[model samples]
Target: MTIAIVGGTGPEGSGLALRWARAGEIIIIGSRDAQRAADTAVKLAEKIGGKSSRVSGAENKAACAGAEVVVLTVPFEAQAETLKHIKPALRPGQILVDTTVPLAASVGGKPTRTLGVWQGSAAQQAAELVPEGVAVVAAFHNLAADLLQLDGPVDCDVIVCSDDKEAGKRVRDLARKIPGVRALDGGKLENARIVEQITAVLIGLNIRHKGHSGLRITGLPAEAYEK
Candidate 1:
């Protein structure tokens, strides 16, 4: 699939681009500054080495225009504005994967705390802003950017929530492309309120443990993901 990473200049965006690129998927890094996005894409391509022609870069709107899936990796403060800037390019039948977390850190507060989004969660807010018929799936809230950049497995579970069942499954399939990652069905988009908040708690745990910690759900059979 052609995946566009909006805000691709950021750590999270770049990290995901790197992983997906290595996985042999076509990756487009999108940024407000097209030149910066291009530069980051070049760096990622170089890192991947040998015929990494599948990765490229473009402006946010242009990136969203050509992509089958657009992944938003921006901070909460920039989510609405970024979506607004690229809204025109988002057409019907496109799946938008939102990785935003409304952390207090965006408002000069603690990173271990979350801000209350009037729309209930950042993903829901994204759903409200996008044009009609564009499906929004919330995921990657618990994955660490630093871990994604590393060479080996990330060892985490990505909780994917979307009202659109097919879109949710598509994202879950994409999430499994990363090593050591399991994707779970997190129900409706409204459930994102709970999933997004878990990031704050994970941040707190990371601070205390001095290591990046991730989530894992037990007791479910392997068939759970198949359904």
Candidate 2:
């Protein structure tokens, strides 16, 4: 699938781009500045071997133009503006994955405390801003950025939530492509608020333990994933 990571210049965005690119998926790194996006993609491509042909960079709109999936990994503060900026380029058949957390991590406020989002959650806000045809899903909220940049596998469970069941499943399948990662259906989009809040708890755990933290749900039948 052709995946576009908007604000792909940041660590979270770049890390995901790197992993997906290494997995042999076509990746487009998007940035406000086309040059910066291109530069980052070039550097990242060199890291995984000089095969830069599969991965490229472009302005946000250009990146989303032909992508089958668009992931928004910008900070919470920029989420609204970024979605608004990309709204025109979003089409009805595409899926937009939102990994935004409404945390005060950027400000002086505690990371465990989430800021109030009038639209319920960042994913909900994104759903509201996008055009009718675009399906919005929330995921990857608790994945550690540092872990993503590593060459080894990541041990975690990705809980995917969306009002659109098919869109949510698509994202879950995409998440499963990552090594040692399991994807679980997290119900409706409204449940994203709960899923997002777990980020703060994980963040707090990471800080106290001085290590990257992740989630793993147990007791499910092993055959459940067969489908």
Candidate 3:
């Protein structure tokens, strides 16, 4: 499947594009600056170090045009504006995976603290802003971008939540494409409020422990992720 990472010049977005591209998925790195996005794609392709040509880049709206899935990895402050800019290109039946978190760092505060979003969470705000019929799935909140950039597997569990069951499942499947990562069914979209806040906690932990921390839910049977 072709996936577009909006704001793909950023660390989290570029890291995801790199991993997915390594997994043999078609990845489009989207940015406000088309040249910057293309540059990042070239860097990622070089990192893979092969004839791997599955990754490309474009302006945000253009990137979303033909993608089966659009992953938004912009900061919380830029989320609304970014979505509004790309709304025109989002077609019906497309899945939008929102990885934004309402971290207070966006507003000159500590990354360990979170801002209270009136829309309940960043993902909920995205669901409201996107054009209707585009399935919004909230995910990738707790994973550390530093770890994702490394060559080794990232030991992380992705909690995926959405109002649409199939869309959530599709995103969970996509999340698992990253090595050493597991995807969990995190229930309804409203639950994103809790999941997004976990990022702040994880950030705090990272600061206190001096390590890149991630989440893992134990005791879940393997069938929990089975179709």
Candidate 4:
């Protein structure tokens, strides 16, 4: 499937791209600047190997145009503008994956006031911005940039929550491409608030650990009770 990474130059974009590329999926990296977008494409082409065609780069709209699925990897600040640019290009059945974490860091690298998401959350905001046809899925919010930069087995799982079951499943399938990871369906779109709060806790963990820490959830998959 053709998946377009709308904010592909960012850390989240690169991480998702690397994982999906390793899974042999065609990835198109999109950026505000044509040059930067093309650069990411070139890098992926070299790593994944092809006629330099397996991966490609394009300016925002072009990258999103005709894509079966689209992911938003831009910063919280950029998400609005990027979506405005990409809204016109979205398809009927396309899914928009949001990996944005809204936190305003102070000069000292600590956040003073946590940024509550505009219009509920990055995912919900994206859904409202896009045409009603597009389905927005919140995922990969807590994944470390370092983990995505690696070439093999990602150790973290992404929590996916969406109002649309098929859209959620589409992203769930996308998450499966990365090794040592699983995508847990986080019920419905409203559950994104809980999922997003986890990022803040994880950030605190990273600070305490002094590294790009990862997170996983247990206590799932209950066994069926016998009659």
Candidate 5:
């Protein structure tokens, strides 16, 4: 199974690419520029203790063409533009993972405790735009890429929201490759808003704490999900 990551040059994309590369081969790092993408693939390979051949790079559309899954980690504002260019290329049954956070920039460089949600969360917007044939799964919102790049363990839990149960399960399995990371189903696509907003809270925590990173969710009853 080949996993292709769109906008993989960024931190979130880089971490995901590295994790998957360590566990499996045939990982593609997608970028707007083919050369940049190739460079990202090489760096990812090194991070995972692998050689270059196991990974490759491609332009955004080409990256999604035949891959089993494609993840988007482009910036919030750039999300729509990036997906607009690649929407036609997404294949049927391919899992489209969205990790974009919809929080807006703070004014006057003032770190205000506020959440700027788009009409809907980033995941919802992406899923709405993507063709129905593609299974859009929302996840990786609260994780700090710093935690993911370290070789030891993921040490975090990801809240996964998807309309497609099977696709959500695939993402869950993919999350397993990260040493300590666990993926929990957060129910249908509508729940994406809940998961995406946690980033705002995390940001608030970081601002108040001054430099602490990594947001993890824990503690739940025996029968309680989202633990």
Candidate 6:
């Protein structure tokens, strides 16, 4: 699949771009600055080595225009602005995976506290701002960027939230493309508030433990993925 990571020049975005690119998917790293996007793409290509040709770069809107799936990995402060910037290029049935977590920790507050979002959660806010046709799916909230950047597999479960089941499944499938990453259904988009907030707790735990902590749910049926 052609995946576009808007604001993808940053650590989180670049990390996912590298993972998907190495997995043989086409990756487009998008940035507000076209030149920065190109530079990041070159850096990713250098890291991927043999799959260097699978990744490229473009302006945010242009990247959104060409991809089957677009992931927004920008900080919470920039999420809405970035969505508005790329809204025009989004088409019907395109899937947008939002990985935004509104952590107060970034602003000198407690890591376990979450800032209030007017639209409930960041994903809901994104759905409101994007055009009507775009299907928004919330995911990757608890992933550790450093772990994602590593060459080894990520040992964690990805909780995917979406009102649209098919869209949710699509993202779940994409999540599994990353080695050792498991995807679980997180119910409706409203549930994204919980998924997003969990990041704050994880951040707190990571800081205390001095580790890149990830989640793994227990007591689920073996066929959980089928549902």
**171 Cα displacement, candidate 1 (Å):** 0.5
Candidate 6 least-lDDT 10 residues:
103-112
Question: Which residues of candidate 1, in runs, are more than 4 Å off?
Answer: none
In model 4, where do residues sit more than 4 Å from their true spots?
A: 50-52, 106-113, 222-227
Which lDDT tens digits does candidate 3 get at residues 91-160? 9999999999899999999998899998898999999998889999999999889979998899899999
Q: Identify the runs in model 6 with alpha carbons over 4 angstroms from their true place.
A: 105-108
Ranking of predictions according to lDDT: 1, 3, 6, 2, 5, 4
How close is every model to the real structure, measured as TM-score?
0.98, 0.96, 0.98, 0.91, 0.89, 0.96
Better of 5 and 6 by lDDT: 6
- Over 167-210, each residue of candidate 5 has an lDDT whose tens digit, in order, gives 99888778766777767878898898888877777778778887
Weakest lDDT window of 10 consecutive positions for candidate 4: 105-114
Query: What lDDT does candidate 2 reach at residue 4?
Result: 97
Q: lDDT per residue, candidate 2, 1-227, as tens digits?
A: 99999999998899888888888889999999999999999999898895567789999989999999999999998998999899989998999999999998756688878887898998999999899989999999989888898888998888899999899999988888888788898889998999999999998888899988989989988754532
Error of 5 at 8 (Å): 0.2
> What is candidate 1's lDDT per residue for 1-227, written digit by digit as tens?
99999998899999989888888889999999889999999999899997479889999999999899999999999999999999999999999999999999999999999999999999999999999999999999999998998899998999999999999999999988898899999999999999999999999999998998889988999977555
Per residue, candidate 6 scores C-alpha lDDT tens digits across 1-227 of 99999999998899889899998999999999989999999999999899999989999999999899999989888988889889989999899999999888656777689998888999999999988878899999998898899889997899999988999999999998888788999999999999999988888898889999898987899788545
Model 3 CA lDDT for position 128: 95
Query: Candidate 4 has which clashing residue pairs, if any?
Result: none
TM-score of 4: 0.91
Model 1: lDDT of residue 38: 94
Q: lDDT of each prediction vs. the true structure?
A: 0.93, 0.90, 0.93, 0.79, 0.80, 0.91
